[model samples]
Target chain A: MNAQYRHSQPGYLMILIGVILLVVAAFVWVYGLQPLEIILGAIGIFLLAFGYKLTVEIKNGFLRFWFGLGIFWKKIAIEQIVYCEPFRGVFAGWGIRFVWNGWLYNVSGMKAVTVVLKSGKKIHIGTDEPVQLIEAINSVLHGQVGVESTQMWSEVKADYLKRVEQALSVARHPRSFEILADVGNHLDRRFTELEPRQQTWENFQRIITEMGPPSEYAELVNEDKKSGRLKLTKLEMSAIGVLLVVFGVSAYFYPQMPERIVTQWGFHGQPSSYMPKPVGMFGTPVIFAVLVIALIVIPRTASVSVNIEGFRRFYGGLLIVFSIVMLAVQYQIILWNLGIKTNPNVVGIISVSAIIVWMAFRFYRARRHN
Target chain B: MNLENWQTQLRKGLLDIVVLNLLNRGPSHGYEMVQTMKRIDGLAIREGNIYPVLARLQTDGLVTSYSEPSTDGPPRKYFKLTEAGQKALEDMNKHWDQLISSLESIRKGTGL
Candidate 1:
């Protein structure tokens, strides 16, 4: 098979479908699914997304090829990339990315595509629009070759050139006979030649390399091509995961806060009160445990991707800080609910004020004269 | 009519047409196709999201590519559809037609 194509499997769709499933899981959690049941459901989601594929591949050179069958996707030869740029805000910098020449390809949320030269310099481009990206990379690559405008072929035929021309014409809706006639003549000529038939066996492989559009997605397809074991990075996604282990220990023997430990040791006697929960022994602790998971994990779990304007950096920084603040707030709330000797309202006010100050500074920095 | 929104909708609906039309010309590359689409009046924000769809079509054996040394950087990929892709395009057109007729019928009957 030519390097131009990518195979998508039930595994690929598993990740996709996982998006909805995650939502379902959340709903189940919120609506009182048993904790064990919810945890099991989450495990199922992780398994499906990480199903039996263990390898992925990416070809580098003039055409980068990505292919795989398991956990490790194809290697995207760093040498092939030009540069990785971020879309800070204008685009859905978070989810989508585009290459400058205009071909959009999304590297994974954590990565972006760039073209690298033999000498090792990189330039940013997107995977979404391959045509423009190719042209841009071509311009950089073949600086000596004068650009030839490949006009849209206007005639209707089995060929794609004519179809583009027809679309262009339809788009323009040329209302005059002179323009229409000129277009008719323009569309008929063959734009480019397909290789002669005898070497089709050769062409098959050659064609894979030659077809630019689909190959644009070779890396992503390769990423989905296969994998069995989960990536360590993927496993660390939910803080709740790590927290679950802590939950058991915390439930079995509540971890003492430094202040409580001090009192317990008699350095500060009088048994400073710390209500672990209100009524049901497990109720307060469970809610506290869940809150800890939410505060420390959810924001960090967000998927990151580059956009035209440095969106990756922007989101990364914000998510980290957001998670920390949530942790602080959750801890405070849990403390207050337990009748700990602390004024949570004061802590809440301070946190809210800090967030405001942070936002103000961020706005100032974002809007400051560059 | 707000042109941007209209263009966005048109681009989404016609992306296949755009992709098909680009391929019909002769084999071009993915980047080349994207550039061509961007030049059209209403397309915007090409991302990783769209490529998977293209890959899906290719996996079904609709489109194909071959690499050629790029004058600038790495070898560039050129793309074209197989008979399967064209057939899929035709199928898409049929669905489009049914959708259009249904909408048109609704417009006539409701007069809203």
Candidate 2:
């Protein structure tokens, strides 16, 4: 009902919506490097927190648009929009998505809506589909043709009043406001969902891929050119990037290539039986590869599953174990190749002792202090 | 695999072509794209991959997105071919074909 101020930068809202997905994904993937998770998660939350804006416009007669990040967006022309209903959520991943024609669309803090488009494509706009918007489209598409300006003005006034009431309500009961704020957030998100009035396949993949993940439900998040998340896709990609870099560097400087592969076992290089296999130290990158693989394989998402955090833990644990194993293997081989005989037990104990102690310290800090 | 070195970039390049060609069929969602990518090859694309190339295309205005609901859940951002994206794919395909021919020549010379 109120006149919503148009935002100058929808990009902010887009980035904000994106970060929320990442934080949720990180919380779920809880299987990677602690420092990396927190570092990335913090950045994500920051962008999202500052990214709220309003800039939905319908330039052509063909579409009605609402845009934002955190929520989902579904478009239906007035003719095709079969019904706009306030209903329970669908697309119930971590949260429920809005709907129209039995399809998932967007999610705000908590509401959902479904719409049937003129083209017969069904869409689930957000539940928080600004009622004022519904009326505008209803009148516009069906032709408010000659509805008195008074009715439109009154509608705008009514919406403004609702916004005012919500603001006052927040001031009165801060805690309840927090809950409502969550609800309001759902609405804010709903706005972002419309960032691209047209969420084509290219758009969806593009945005979601940028989010970085091992999310169990990467598919749930949408990407359409305008903007979205790609955490899980990016994670795999970054790994691929690393692999390419490793191989590329190896190819570029063949001599720098490490002779051994590290895993749960230390510097485990097999002899090619050509020239006393060079006593090369391949420990670091080998361990890095193991860590990368573990993290990527641990599926996660901020949607239905809260896996990022768990995934990080799983991957981190794997990395820690692999690192220790590789370290021992590396040291033992160094001794062997040098013609020095160190007792297996002595080498193993000496190499693993420090890591074991460090891990214990990490455990105590993670559980209690950190 | 000699592919080891250029794999990521090669894969990234291939991703551009795959997404555009698939969208040419009709608008599709992120999941649909990944599944189709798998059907094509030793292509080795993960479910989590290519979302970026889609993003890059969009950033460059070669593609656009819109949401549609499915019986399953949340709205999916459906991708369709944009004129610019289609043109880019055509160019990529030409170069790819030429590159294959050049590599074939190398294979023949080696006579293995």
Per-residue alpha-carbon lDDT of candidate 2 for residues A154-254, written as tens digits (9 for 90 to 100): 23323432443333332232122122222222222222343333334444444334322323112211234113222444445655565555545434543
Best by TM-score: 2
Model 1 per-residue lDDT tens digits across residues A1-370: 3332232223343455556666776766554433322434554465454532222222223333221223322234433443322322223221122222222223223223344332222333323343454454444443434223211111112132223223323222111111221222222111223222322334333332332222223322333231211122322344345345434543554433333321111112123233333222344345545555454344343222111123323333344444444444445434543557554344434545555565455434432311
| Fnat: each model in turn | 0.11, 0.00
* Superposition error at B93 for model 1 (Å): 2.0
Clashes of 1: 112
Would candidate 2 be rated incorrect, acceptable, medium or high by CAPRI criteria?
incorrect
Show what share of the native A-B interface contacts model 2 retains: 0.00
Candidate 2: stretches off by over 4 Å:
A1-370, B1-9, B110-112
**Best-performing candidate as measured by DockQ:** 1
Tens digits of per-residue lDDT for model 2, B12-87: 5566777787888888866677667767765657554455455456656678877665543334667677898788
If scored against the real structure, what TM-score would every candidate get? 0.26, 0.27
Q: For this target, which candidate reaches the highest lDDT against the unseen true structure?
A: 2
